[model samples]
Target chain A: MDNRPIGVFDSGLGGLTVLKEIIKVLPNENIVYFGDTARVPYGPRSKEAIIKYTFQAINFLMSKNVKAIVIACNTATARSLKEAQSKYNIPIIGVIEAGARTAAYSTKNKIVGVIGTEGTISSKSYNVEIEKLDKDIKIVSKACPLFVPITEEGWANTEVAYLTAKEYLKELLDQGIDSLVLGCTHYPILKRTIGKVVGEEIKLVNPAKETAKDLYDILGKQDILRTVNKDNPIYEYYVSDIPEKFASIGQQFLKRDMDDVKKIEIQKY
Target chain B: MDNRPIGVFDSGLGGLTVLKEIIKVLPNENIVYFGDTARVPYGPRSKEAIIKYTFQAINFLMSKNVKAIVIACNTATARSLKEAQSKYNIPIIGVIEAGARTAAYSTKNKIVGVIGTEGTISSKSYNVEIEKLDKDIKIVSKACPLFVPITEEGWANTEVAYLTAKEYLKELLDQGIDSLVLGCTHYPILKRTIGKVVGEEIKLVNPAKETAKDLYDILGKQDILRTVNKDNPIYEYYVSDIPEKFASIGQQFLKRDMDDVKKIEIQKY
Candidate 1:
């Protein structure tokens, strides 16, 4: 079994949600997470810049000798995953394919709705992945750009969240999608509100969960699973900018106190 | 009179509102507007980074031979204005001082409310400027971080805007502010909804208008006012990245079609 830590990185603290899932699925794995807080909200950035940033993140995690890398951000995944997989030696996983696979398998009516940042929705990666699996699956995708900010504001259970979800999901609901994917990493926190608006009939696919499962499956197959430690797993956190807010808002997202967060100059990579 | 264009730059498209006002104030002057669309929303960035970005923008504008510069963004003004002015020879003015001056002039009750991004509010630039003019005046500052995204989404007139303004302005209204400064450039676009919430008694101090007035005064005093052209004065736009959405949303912010838009690599500056 591999003793090396797994690497996870996102544009910002939204990636913490994915880390939470990894902790649940692989309790013994030491994980190193990097948040690119300095140049975050990778949604509006150009594909070249996103690719550059993703490589920077991966390289930084590699410097720490990670066994595997998980691109926790959907925008980064949709934009940079294929190129990254080809370039990197280690098994690199992105949230898009795993979520798409889960949604495709879970859907009973052959209809799926996807909601994410402008960058992720524009890339149509989910559509491409789903289409690869099942050509007949009808895809209804909506770009909910404001959802990230609203979720970060800690308004997940508030009227703001409800109204926003209602407004964004109305069109998708009308299309009679049987399953919907929470495409953005920040989305799972708002699942209750989204689920309430979409109702219980529609299955909600959280990408973080599927992504963790995918990582676990890969690690097991490759014989890179970490031995279970008697003590707590050591999770090192690195950020491209200040980490105080990361600790505060991130703790809310992860529902755990952040430990050993340090700032790194990402551009140096 | 100088025939050169006036340089106006913001961290993003919010500066276009200032450009729109400058057009109204100095119809004869040519204008060069740069939106650092690639590394935008400078509110959460460090002071050194903000100053570097401002200088990068200034250097780019100077290369185009702008006679003067307007720091149209509140956060940039708060963090980089003095440092930029000291380094550059041109007459550079920031929106904060002018907005404070206007708020000082307009407020009868000596209580003013200021709304802007977290960076702007945290810097207390408006409070410092206003206090310099009138020490006795009470300042109620609130950071409405979500407003910019909402404004960019074209939800300025919707129920969402109304509710957001209502929620944000409640404390300021309770503090009995006679005038409110729209401290962020994006805030002016939501003035109607903000006005409706704050009511008829409170005067809305729009920094863009005051900044335009400040620029006009500087140009006139420096004897560098642009001469009237036979045709319309040319306006050039530059961004660090793609200008597709810039043409559309920027037009909405500028209230006119944009012309001569170009993409530049800002880091080179």
Candidate 2:
């Protein structure tokens, strides 16, 4: 059994939501999370830059001796997941596959909606993965570029958020999608607003929970599950920018107080 | 007369608003612009990272032999203007001084409102500059961090934009501001929405126009104004990410077709 900490890497703090899920699923496993706060919102950036930055984050996590790595950011996953799995020796997991699978299997009408950052949507990673799972499953996707910033601004429940959500989801709703995938890590925070806009009929699939379950299964399959139960599993947080800012928003995302955050020069990786 | 291009730099396409004004003010001058689209929204980044990026952009412009440089981004201007002026030999200008000066001078009731990105507002550049211009002018500032992304999404005139502006301006309007500064470059694009929210009584100060005037004055004072009128003054655009994305949004900002665009490795500079 491997007692090494699992590494969680995101372009920013949105991955805290995924880490929270992981903690719930693997209570005894240690976690080391790195948020690339300096060059965040990988949404509008070039694919080359996203891949480069993703590798750097993975390299940093590898140096920390993580048993496995989870690319928690959708843009990073969509752009660099395949290459990263090939490059790293450890079990490298990305958010897209599990998310796509869940949406593909759950949709009764064979129509699914996916919303994410520009990079993730344009990559068509969700469409690709879902199509592989079921060729007949029709996928509709749109890039809601403002969602991340709106979430970060803490306006998730405001009128502006509702309006923005309605504007973004209208097209997908018009296409009669049965299931919607919250493809970006940050999108989960705006679930209430999105739900109000899309109504109760459409199932909102959050990849964070499914990803955690996938991580647990993979660890067991690889015979790397932490067998011994610790009184307290250590959780460490590292960010490339202000720790205070990360801690503030992170507490909101994780739904718990976080004081073990530190700043690192991520560029060195 | 200096025939070299005048460099304008921003975190992303937001600077094109400022560049458009510069083109109007100095029709005969050649222009070179660099947008760090790869690592944009400097609003949420650390001060150290902002300064480093600002210097890198400046260095790149210097390498291009620019006669002068304009820090077209409010966040970069607020964070690095003074240090940049000290580091570079060529005349360096930032958007803050002119913006602050305009608001400070135009206010009728001595209460001026400032709205910008989190970085710009938190830096208190406008407040500091306005206070310096006139100590008695009461300044109220709020960070509307979502405006940039909303503007970039091309929803600047939509209901979402109106709601966002109304929410952000509520406090400033309640405080009875006589004049408002569109402190971020992207904010100018949302002028119609913002003006509607704050009403006609409160004059909106677009720093782009004032900044262009400031640049014209500085060039004349420094004996660097372009004297010879070329029928076609060259305008070159460079970005750290996809040039096509920049050109498309840039055309909207500039109100002219942009064909002279190139991609650059900004991290190297």
Winning candidate number (TM-score): 1
What is candidate 2's DockQ?
A: 0.52
Please report how far candidate 1 places residue B111 from its true position, in Å. 4.1
Docking class of 1: acceptable
Model 2 TM: 0.86
lDDT of 2 by residue, B101-174 (tens): 89988998999999887777777889888988889999998988788878877888999999888888999999
Compared with the true structure, what per-residue lDDT tens digits does model 1 show for residues A77-191?
8889998999999999998889999999999999999998877887899999999999999999998877887877787887877887898899999999999999999999999
lDDT by residue (tens digit), candidate 1, B1-269: 67899999998899999999999999999889999988887877779989999999999999999999999998898899999999999999998898899999999989999998877887888999999999999999988877887888788888877877887899999999999999889988998899899889899999899889989999999999986677678889999977446788888899998766899999999
TM-score of chain B of 2: 0.95
Which pairs clash in model 2? Answer: none
For candidate 2 chain B, the 10 contiguous residues with the lowest summed lDDT are: B241-250
Superposition error at B140 for model 2 (Å): 2.7
